[model samples]
Each structure stands twice: as C-alpha cells, then as structure tokens.
Target chain A: MAIDAVIPFKPKNPKTRLSCVMEQEERETFARAMLADVIAASCEGGCSPRLLCTAPYLHPTAEVCVDADGLNESLNRVLSAASSPLLIIMGDLPLADGAAIRRLVSTEADMGIVPGRGGGTNAIFLRHPGRFRADYYGASFLKHMAIADEAGLSVEVIDSFRLHTDVDEKEDLVEVLIHGRGEARRCLQSLGFVLSVEGGRVGVERRTHKETL
Target chain B: MAIDAVIPFKPKNPKTRLSCVMEQEERETFARAMLADVIAASCEGGCSPRLLCTAPYLHPTAEVCVDADGLNESLNRVLSAASSPLLIIMGDLPLADGAAIRRLVSTEADMGIVPGRGGGTNAIFLRHPGRFRADYYGASFLKHMAIADEAGLSVEVIDSFRLHTDVDEKEDLVEVLIHGRGEARRCLQSLGFVLSVEGGRVGVERRTHKETL
Candidate 1:
C-alpha cells in the first residue's frame, strides 16, 4: 500500500527568516519551488503526496487539502483519519530527495522521525497514525518522541543530512545551492544568488539587486 | 590546538542491554572494541581522544580519565576545566568514522550535536566548553539544546547515520556488520555472529554457540 505523505505548508508569510536576503514575493516563490521538490520526491519514494496548505492552493502533482487551523491541528485531523501508514514531511526541506524519503519510510519501526537542525521535526513516518498526534513547534522532535513512547509505540530516529537541512535563514541557502537538485536550486540561482566564501565560511550573496521604487 | 575528545564509558557492567545476546565477559570485550573504534576515529579527525571511564583503564592511542562519579558529573568536571574546544562521543558508535568526526567538528556553530536513535546524544562538539555542561541519559539531546540556548550559544545538529547508530541491542550489531570498519566488527564476526533474516527483518545469529556445561 502506498503511504500517505502529508506536507504541511503555510502559503502566506512563508520563509520569513530568509527576509534578510530575499524579498517577500521571492520568498513565496522560493517556498513553492521547495514544495514542488518535496512533492516530487514523495511520489518517487512510492508515496502519495498531499499538501496540507494553510490556504486554498493547487498543485499539479499533489492532492491539496486546505486547513485554516495551525500546523498541529491541521496535521492531527489528517492523522486521525489515516487508515494506513502516514509520512509528514516539512515542505521547507529542499535538500531532501527520493533517496532520503526512501530511507525514512523503509525503517522497520512503528514511528520514524527526522529531527531538524535546531529542535524542529523535519519529517515523521507513523505506522499507526490514529494512535499518534502532531505537536509541531519548538522542540517538536522531542515532543513527538515522548508522545510515541507514551502511546507504547516504538520510535526510530532517521538521521540524514538531506532530510534534516531545512532552508530557513539566508545561511541555509548555501546547502541548497551546493546539494540541491531541483526547482529550489534553479529558483535561487535564477534570483542571482551565489555562494560567497569569507574567512573560511560559505554564505549566499545576491549578485543582482532588485530595483527600489 | 587539538580539540579534546572526552569519551564517557562505563568499564564495569557495561552494555547490560546486550547481556541477553552476550555473556558478561563478551559484553565487556565488545564494549572495549567499540570504544577503541571511537577513539581511533576521534584521533583521525584531529582531536585528542581521552577515555572518561567509570573505572581505571589504559589505551595505547588515547589518554584515560577515570571518574566513577556517573556520566554527567564526570563529563562536567572535564567540560568545566577545558581550555579548548571539546568533543564528547559515546563509546558504542562503532560505525562512526574519521569523516563523521570531521563533519561534526567542522560545523561553524558554538555547539554541534549528533542525536542517537532514541533521545540520547551520541556525539557533541563544544567550541566553548566552560559555558556549557554535559547532560546525558533520557532525552539528553533536547536538554543539551536547551542548555546551549540558555547560554546564548549557536547550535548545529549534525544529522549523520553512522554517528547516530549506537550499539545497545543485539539488533544494532547488524549495522556494525554492514557498515563498520573497525575492531568492533572484527570482534563480532570472530564470535561467529552473522546476519539472520527472519520474516523480512534482519537480526544476528551466533553460528557457533558456546558448548553448554
């Protein structure tokens, strides 16, 4: 059976942390490119991709489910109704590819999780979806582990560089440019973003400045 | 200056979880082999390996610091007195290699952590050891993150499979057999341990069981 992959995305005000380097409109476009990459990866990994968007939106590849509620509430609704195994992958992980998705879903455990850079959960694979609930926010990775333990479910943490690297800040753009192989990289490159090395540190530098009014 | 790699190990009654699969003496030998692998990796990664054992022990390639006062206390003692960057890697991660260690210490953040399969912290690279303390045990990964946040330290979580996979159970031996290139793997294979596939699940089976009394 094909696992259901629920990708929760905020259509409005997305990638706000990248505001220092990208304009509001560019952030939205970059976010969509990332979403597209995730959806494609999900499909290639033998799962059905469904976008749990904050607002009404359409994606050609994935099934769209709009929810006004926050990330936790929105995911809980889908999780409660899930009949089979479900995978919840954050849309911002542009570096995640088909291989990373396959590695996560192939784990032999009741629950598989990929923790993000800080304390966020980048992706989760739940065998018994009805028995678990999503509590995404600060330290959600730890919270999810506790929730699974309380429910008497076995948890396996999938540690992968591609799955854990979520593009949030401007510094995160360097990874996407270096390892990304999808629309997200093209979008960033098209926007004149280039890698800059200063004092043995790599960061993104915008080559073309947008004209101000 | 070479970074100080402090490896916290319990020399006595170590690897109690693997007792079901191995005898007391076998577990001790296995634990030592794993520790040797980690120490070698640390040295190859440009850090000075130091075993912070619960009991007195000696190694040819690394220094040994015996502190019977539990894991947290012993590690904090070293962390408090450290004048340079310090790394703490669990002794059971036999799959972790020099590249894994290099990837962790190369991070630009003040702290870099590799979370174990469960909530445990497998490896930590602390740039400012005095500003932080060691906290191992249940959910130590999250606790360390909180501690770093309180100290106003930038944290980078290095998500790597080899670093995160620690040998605690009989099933974990499969990973060492598959990906390990160290004394631990040779020790396991020498004991006639081989991968056993039962119902599409991989496990370990002792080919030559010890003669019964």
Candidate 2:
C-alpha cells in the first residue's frame, strides 16, 4: 500500500518560454518555488515523494535520484526503482493540491493519466513497474492512454485543471498570477511583477524595479 | 492607389472564453474599445477604415456595412463590394498599431497575410478581389497560404507580434493588462482587477469593487 511519488525537476535553465517576460535569475527562482510547492502537495497527499533531478538544487526532505539522461530514461529509471505503486508528477504544476493528488492516487484503476496544457502528460499513477513505457513528449496524454490500453490495463483519466496547468509560456503566467498561491506567487511578486490590462488583453508587467536577488 | 480596410466587429458576446474571469458587460465594452483601437490604427496607416457589423454599435467616421451572415460569408461580401486594394483586419487585435498595418499594406505581394494568436488570421491585404478566399477558422494562416499558392498569387507573410496577438482567451487578458495602453487599460483598472500572487502563481483579485457601468 506504499505509494512513492517521482517528481521530475529541471532546475537549471527553467521556464525558458517565460524568458520573454521574466529574467533568467527570476525564472530559476520561480521554477524552484513551483517544485517546492509540487513536492509539498505530493507529501500532503500521503505519498513519499522522490526528486529525479538533473541539477544540484535539492528539495530538503525528498529523496533525490540524479539522472543525466533524457526525460523518458530518467523517469523510466525512477519507475523501475520503486517497489510499490508509483506516481509521476511534473514539477511545474504550481496549483497542485492534496485533494487532487489524493484523488489521482485513490483511483481504483491499474493506471491513471492526467493531460497537461498544450498536449503533454502532467501526471500518471501506475500500479506496476513496467506495465507501460513512459512517453512524456508532445501530445503525451493520448500516447500514454494508448500504451495503457494496448497492455490491457484499466486506465482512469483524471480531468483536473489545477493538475494540468503547467507553467510553460508567458500566457501561462497569467494562470499562476490569477489562481496561484504560496511560493510561486511570492517569487513573482518579489520580482516586481504586476498584472496590466491594455489592448483588450491581460499580461504581467515588471516596472523600472529590477530584481535584487 | 487606394486601400480600404475592413474590420469585422462582433460587439455581441465578444470573448466568451474570458467568461471565467470577466462579466458579460465588461467583455462587450472591452470588445468595442478594441474595435475602436483597430479603427484608429487603420486610419493612421493611411487606409480608409470600414466596419462590417452584425450589431448596431458604430465607429464614428468609419463606413458601416451591416451584415447578418457568418464570418466567412460576410467578409467575402465586403471583399466583393470593393474595387481597389482591400485590407481585412480582425477587431480583436488590441495591440495592433499603425506601424504594423503600414508594414502589412506596403508589402508588394499580391496577398499579404498576418498570422493571429492561437491559429487564426489577424490581418490580410489583398490586391485582387477574388484571388484567394479567407479561411479564418482554426490554423487559418497556413490554410490562407495554401489557398494563395493554389490561386497563383504571391503571398507575403507579415511577422509582427502586435498584429499576431488576438485577444480571445482568458489567458490573453494578461497580455492586455501587462503591455496594453489607452481605453482597454483604463476600463480594466476601473473594474478593480488587481494582480495577486498566491499558491505559487499570479492571478487577478478584485477588492471591494464592482463594475460602475
């Protein structure tokens, strides 16, 4: 009955799409805050979380598994290492809460897959070690579902917006600004980010105030 | 020698995706303001502006062409009525400016197409009335380019961020708030929308304020 959660985090050179609006130092800081928030949610959901890392920055309490390979191999390695039910969650989900994570893990299916924003797999809960291979690239949710189906595994699709909204683009920053709480919000505010309305649209604005960090 | 710019304005039910955040009255007012902004930009670009409308709201000096048909048909009707070079601009481009429009029209190709955000046509400059049909639905920029190719018309793709950013989704409201100017900004400000950072994200928070209009 032990559930181990694997959170993949790319702390080095993170949130590049947000580079259009955020400076490099701030992007890294914001990414770490999001990772911390995701890890906190996983632990709060009664799961022992593991960090699969490429960079040196480590979450204080989570067990760190360093892997230099691509996302597929690193995740696969972590999945192989687990002795019980495994959960794979993306680090960028700032709005991930305990109830959502608990719901995902508590599902009765052999596997559960959650679709990410703009065609990616956000979260997957697998009961077996090698029931299906993890293909976490473009349009991955459908691919994961198909893999689970081919293996004749019962799959549960967890349709949760908070679990799906990964911080990927400048447009995505709005979701965080409008609905996000905790570390990510504090990081953005400290960076002097403000929401502005003009030209029939909304976006983040950092005034003459530069990042002191 | 003359360039007539046709801006299609759907003043009724402007941005439905933004219904998650903004009320109906605010969305309509915002859409009308964007239409006015587009008209001003078109006029400043040395193009005679015209509004092809389904509703009764009129831009002060621009010629109003009332149409009850669908988007594709209404646009085709306006195109057929024009004798000189015709320019088609979407009413939702709040960030559109005179420079972008001037660049679009000044292109020497038989057809000039500007790509919109989330895969739609933002602006089109056509020298021939029946050269290529406008397909402004779902990834229409590529569809337009293919159409122009089949018609043996030279297509010029004008790459401008301001012209490409169409205000359609709730996420798009962030762009307007961050980088917008004039009426749209003033309107949102009066609505008491403030950027709040929480739960590791940024979001809009209204504090003790209701829409005055």
DockQ of each candidate relative to the true complex: 0.07, 0.02
Candidate 2 local lDDT, B20-62, one digit each (tens): 7778998998887778778878887888888888877666688
Candidate 1 — which pairs collide?
none
TM-score of 1: 0.56
Q: How close is each model in CA RMSD to the real structure? A: 16.1, 20.9
**Most accurate candidate by DockQ:** 1
Model 1: CA > 4 A from native: A209-213, B1-213
lDDT per residue (tens digit) for residues B29-51 in model 1:
99999998998888888888888
User: Which CAPRI level is candidate 2?
Assistant: incorrect
lDDT: worst 10-residue window of model 2 chain B: B194-203
Docking quality level of the chain pair in candidate 1: incorrect
Error of 1 at A77 (Å): 0.9
